[model samples]
Target: MKFEVTILGSNSALPTTKRFPTAQVLNVLERFFLIDCGEGTQIQMKRFRLPMSRINHVLISHMHGDHIFGLIGLLSTFALQGRKSDLHIYGHSKLEKLIRFQLELLETKLDYEIFYHTIFGTNIQTLFEDDSLIVQSFPLKHGAMPCAGFLFKEKERLRTLKSDMLSFYNIPIKNRHGIKQGDDFICDDGEVIPNDKLTKDAPKVRSYAFCTDTAYLPKIVPIIAGVDLLYHEATFLKTEEKRAKKTYHSTAEQAGKIAAEAKVKKLLIGHFSARFDDLKEHLEEAKNIFPNTALAEDGKIFSVELDRD
Candidate 1:
């Protein structure tokens, strides 16, 4: 069961020599979920060797051009590739209209169907779920536009049956599923074999949170508390705190503080402003507040695993 995030683009409002914009791909157990689609996202995906066919869901944080400008191009490319599976998009209600208008105006017809799930208002809500994972959306304070952040949580895994004990108990193959679900086994002699003795605890549930293009809001701490990995936007340095606040973006230090307050295992800061030529200052500012912080650079991959400690 692999869980990881690959950064496609990390720059803020503009594309730089190295950075594109805001885009990421969360690979949960081999299934790809795209988060944001800034300009050049397809190129970045190809550069990183990520297969476009694997991405079925797209999560847009906001309506900002830097955050979603690449969606049309990606979809068109998918069509050109003769994709047949439906693509699901989760975002602000207005996004549906915007995408439809663009596709219609361009007279672009795709072979696959597009399903839009509208996320309305600023409330915390569950956006998607399956037997293995759950995705929740929460509102972010991003000025006039309706913005959101996402939390991805893996479901509690089934316990692993002890191989030695299974043979000793002569457990039937058909009963494995029940035992993994925490059921006790009954022997031929009617002896009860405890579930704990027959199986080992499964891996701990892992979680990741994505927060970007928002101001410093402490209320989100409770929603994303104790996540394994947190990707928060650090669009500016502490020296430009006023500009960050004015634009409803977070400074590097501010993003670090949020990670500390949320008690997440690791923090990834990105969405860098194009004005800066280097990220040394941003990394320094964030690391000063949260030592576990890492810079989110394009093509970087972060794995999400259980925090053994």
Candidate 2:
């Protein structure tokens, strides 16, 4: 039930001494999702002690070099390590083509299969889902590039059964599953026992949204609204708003505004410009609008703890 996101790299297009490009790993119930593999991402993963073997889903936001340069290396390493599990990559058609071209050019024979899921159009749609979790993709305002934002959502779980109550009512084994699914119990006397009396509330559903390398986009508010944690790109400060617009990147203030509008619980700002030697100002700028904002540092892990049942 562990849920957390580890920042592998946090720099923008440039690779600074303190920061690499953009890369992250989201671990939900040990199902790892690698997001935006920038240059040196493999090294970062190693440095952070992440188990690369656990990563099966790779989500690329776009075909930008700073966002995807390290992907080839990671894929190669997976082959070198003799990974057998099939890897599922989600991104634009161009990304699949680029990866295919590189793999062909290198003549590298992989030890596993790679399944590509193309992200197209501007509509928000489910990219992956299961009984306990779901991941969706939404379009970002990165000009000319088919970039996307991702939302990771934990599904509502079954109610927690109270052992003492179940025993007291002599609930049948066959009826326990239904009770967990929010059904009332009927005794031999035909008395209906309330579900609330027999079970505790289920854990609160958690959600995380990742939005990077995009311009100030308010249209994503509805899609990412009220998420438990939100990681948004702040590639510039408000002093360079015009520059941010020109580069189709967001400023710290803009990121904060988006978080506030979306009403997310916490905002994580990253994708910093190389010019910034210190990120204090960027954090401050974001805190101006969204007080619960924090900077996304390389190798840092932000965890969302499970709710009490």
Candidate 3:
């Protein structure tokens, strides 16, 4: 399965010429999971040629305007496109009421089922799951009423059979499926071939973490530990540590420290404050702690490939 993430918006509370707000899309195989739809998110998807129909699951971290202002527009576009696929939304309870109010006031009935799952207190709860992937949410220390960070992990696949062993034993195609599923097959000659001997190990699972608008909190270390890629909000520099605490935000260095402590493979820091024009210092600060740290820029795609089984 193919795994990738695209940054739609990376700005903080306001929109700049280069960056918007917080929004991203994680493409797991053919399906897309939209995370935190901010202002101009639909426009961003159009810019990247992403199939709007492919996105049926939307995960909102909080009720902030920058994180949800684009939802109404996106839903309206879905309606205009004559979509009939069911859409599942996971967020806080208030978001459900908010979306319902908008749809009621506009008198626009959706063409498909809209399932809403409200996540109350976060304690590494599984918000949504399926055969391909599982998504979990954890509480964040942001000043909002309630905020969360999401973790996406691809489901484990069955092991593959060895070509030499398959033909050597004259294994039928029907039996091949059983062998791939870790079942031992008996040959006509009565030769015993163990599943472990005939098949290689399964591919390592890949996971991505999305965290934003939070202060430096180590409580999430276990929830986001050892992620393949982590996108953490770094709205300020170390010099503004005081301001970061006051505003319930994190510095680039703090974000890097968390990434390093969590042992994540890579880290993408964003949510830049309006004070700085150049982000070289921010990158330098993060890299000082986590060597694989990168800056999150709008309209940029980060690709990740999983190992073969």
Candidate 4:
């Protein structure tokens, strides 16, 4: 299965000529999940060639304009394209009101149903789950705004049957499911065939965490520990630590600290402030603490895999 995260926008607060605000798309086994929809997110998506119709679930970190301003435009475009699948949006209570009011004022109706799941309070909980994957939401410290971060995890996969061994053992086709489920096969002579001889272990489950628009909070470390990939907001540099604290944002160093504390396999830092024209300092600062850190650039894609460490 293909699991990757594509950065659509990676700036913070304001959009510059080269960078847009915050938005990302996570593709797990071809299913796309969008995170944050800042202004110009649609344009970024188009530039990256990510099909809007493939994104069925949209997760919002906060109500800040830099995080959610492009939602209306994206939804409107989906409606214009005659999309009929129900779209699921998970966010705070105000998001529903904001979207519904905008559509009502424009007298525009959507062909698809919009299902809103309001995440209330500040508790870490499972937001969605299915046979293949699961998504969880945890509260983030983003000043007065009730913000959240999402964790996407792949479920345990079924073991694979060794075709050559199965043929050697003369196992019937009806017993394939039992072998995959780790059950021993009983032959006509009542001899037991070991499950390990017929099957191989499945790939390890992979997880990705999205932590943006939050301050340096250590409490989140345990919740996201040992993830395969972590995308944290580095809205400022270490030199602007005081300003970052005041605005409840994280510096590159702070983001690196979180990733190191959580023991994640790789760290992706983004949500850069527009004051700086380059990201050399951000990359250097983060790498000083976490050597596996990388800067999140627009249209960049990161693949999720089992951590060798």
Candidate number achieving the greatest lDDT relative to the actual structure? 2
TM-score of each: 0.97, 0.97, 0.95, 0.97
Off by over 4 Å in 1: 306-309
Would you list the C-alpha lDDT of every candidate in the order shown? 0.93, 0.94, 0.89, 0.93
Query: In candidate 1, what are the lDDT values of residues 181-283, reduced to their tens digit?
Result: 9999998889999999999988889999999989998999999999999999999999999998999999999999999999999999999989988899999
Candidate 2 Cα deviation (angstroms), residue 137: 0.6
Per-residue CA lDDT of model 3 for 93-167, tens digit only, reads 999999999999999878987899887855888988888799998899987569989999988877967889888
Clashes of 4: 0
Model 2 CA deviation exceeding 4 Å by range? none
In Å, residue 236's CA in model 1 sits off its true spot by: 0.8
Clash totals for all candidate models: 0, 0, 0, 0
How large an RMSD does model 4 have? 1.5
Better of 3 and 4 by TM-score: 4
lDDT of candidate 4 over 192-274, digit per residue (tens):
98999898888888999999889999999998999989999999999999999999999999999999999999999999999
lDDT of 2 by residue, 1-309 (tens): 889999999999999978999999999999999999999999999999999999999999888999999999999999999999999999989888999999999999998999999998478879999999999999998999878999999999999999999999988899999999999988888999999999998889999999988999999999999999999999999999999999899999999999999999999999999989999999999999999999999989999998963
Worst 10 residues of 3 by lDDT: 300-309
